[model samples]
Target: MLHGGSLPHLTPEETLAPILSALESVLGSARPVALHQPHFAGREWDYVKDCLDTGWVSSVGAYVTRLETALQDYTGVAHALAVVNGTAALHVCCLLAGVIAGDEVLLPTLTFVATANAVSYCGATPHLVDVSPVTLGVDAIRLAAYLEDIAELRGDTCYNRTTGHPLRALIVMHTFGHPAELDALAELCRRYRIVLIEDAAEALGSFYRDQHVGQWGLLSAVSFNGNKIVTTGGGGAVLTNDAALAQRARHLTTTAKQPHPWAFVHDQVAYNYRLPNLNAALGCAQLEQLPDFVSRKRALAQRYQHAFAAVAAGHIVNEPQDTRSNYWLNVLQLHPAYGHLRDALLETCQARGILVRPAWELMHRLPMYRDCPRMDMSTAEHLERHLVCLPSSVDTGSVDTGSEHA
Candidate 1:
């Protein structure tokens, strides 16, 4: 039959019908759909025009400060520094988190490459940790158990007993915009004197127990990529509540230059990673529409959940308890019995103009990270096989109408 082994007790066609119907229903039609794309129905035009007309389109301008101020006010963080991109923001956070050469940073195995690559940029090793089956993120209780088995705290520093590398920080990513268990994780990190950072790149409007996702950690990063809930074409920001940390982030992202007008006097080596004013202008416009986007996305998730509930082969992932997600991308977790049916469904959906994608391969399985220290990733492994990202882009009315409405 269809190349891969057929499902038991069902022919290829028999197994494909229900899934196909469910996919078509959730997509709202059979029209071509991107997994997630920017929705720009705001004052994007006027802002970009303002920047171009005034020639204040570089990294320095009023829009940069305006965007930073907007983010600070929205997230309730004390300071926000706009940056060139999410990866650059994460690198700066790693530097400010005190990550050094040969140090170890704890992270999840089932995450985007950017999450792990950021730790590597600091010359530190990424210690792969397992995630939870329910929340699909780092399990605070489980991580504590694993650390008890292998970690040793001495003189206010935590170290891997076997490898002798200092466990410097823990980077908790809000997987698929679902807020991680920050309360327990924060207390645990506090106990071991481990620095905490949040990779909130996928979670712009997500919240946990009434607090914003990025506010839990000492420092956090949010992305405004073309595909994120809100977009700035390509931009990111570092967030923090502490004034000292915020000042350091601002200084480091600006190439560490001395504050002298018309003087090129320099300080320490740093990065030219500030977000351009042109992009910040777009961000200011996008930020204004974020709440509306989040609302529409939540409604879409509900539709998917209801549609999938009637189909036996499908299950829609909803927000975790005591939390609110922006529903950046809706995940369709198939029944374990139908795991082998996914590739066929994915192929069929694409042939019918629907885009569906699976989760990223676990970091420990990658060739470069093959030798890194890690715990068992059974849950992440299962998720790697069965989860598919459905078309969760915010509703722009119909696929015919471009995502340009405000």
Candidate 2:
């Protein structure tokens, strides 16, 4: 895949036609340059074999503890709870955050729909806010403004003009592995009596102002999906400094049962969202290589940046400098002047055996969230129109674009 800004000169139609033609002609060259892929060096196989041999491939095992320990060390959280997936991690976080039915959770419209979906799963409404052009995370100032507006209107009888629910927490995402302006957002949440939760799913190794991203919020989540920097195939973790919250998450994630295996007494309608030992085995091995993966990913991003500069003028894109990103997905925004070129670029990349993608359609615009209240979605709309994501797999060596395409 090419750098964020560099593209070969071609009109939109010219770019798109090749892709459509190749869709029929180049049957084997349609692989996407994904932002991430699972990384293993036979270690995963060894772990899987070990799990099968030991007959402990389900929920309970040493690997589960090891995975959590590794994450606690990596993220600097006092405790971490392993769960079935990132969405489950977020659901557990919302429960621990005291988010009840009818409560409102503030979220950015630019994030993955799952962030909002998790809130809805708890029966809490999501108040979608616009993202900052710079960080692509929730804009702290805008969030503070929303809180003030809610307070000024006063009482449970009042409704936010932006969203009708009572704003209770702010869920800030470190989008595409870039850290958000979390410090300011944290202070705002504290002042507003709103809970702060970090969706650090895309930013496992990312730092903000020299500190890790997951530790800033009251509770945070990390995803180990097949597409993340590191993968457990499908797993996630919940982080917290509070002991009680960590314990609660652990109990809830393991099915919220009262201890006797034969009794099967459940105090709450708990979900079966535990991360199995087999997945934990993969997570354990992946955790061992995170530092290497992050370093290589960064180097790959740098190579793309430099190559794009030489490949074409005004074509290379780079992440802003204020926050250090894991470089999960290198993004480029087409010039608004070239706004019509976005669709063409995607097609061109596909034709050339590179998989490229446009930014997600705004969550608020999707069918499920169309009725949700959103405030000033101009930024989201602008991004949606111009943004594109190139292939960014950890397994693909930066200079080896041919191998990546293969």
Per-residue C-alpha lDDT of model 1 across residues 1-406, encoded as one tens digit per residue: 2223344577767877877787677676647778887877789999999999999999899999999999988888889999999999999999999999999999999899898999999999999999987778898888999999989999999999989999999999898899999999999999999999999999999999988888888999999998899899999999999899999999999999999989987799999999999999999999999888899889888878777776666588778899998888899887777788878888887888787788898999998888899998888989888898888788722554447632
List candidate 2 stretches off by more than 4 Å.
1-35, 152-164, 310-317, 320-322, 398-406
Candidates' TM-scores? 0.95, 0.88
| Model 2, CA-based lDDT | 0.77
Clashes of each: 2, 7
**Model 1 accuracy (lDDT, Cα):** 0.88
The per-residue C-alpha lDDT of model 1 at residue 18 equals 75
lDDT tens digits, residues 175-278, model 2? Answer: 88888888899898766667899999999989887778888788999998988888888999999999999988888887788889599888887888889999
Q: Model 1: runs farther than 4 Å from truth? A: 1-8, 396-406
The TM-score measured for candidate 1 stands at 0.95
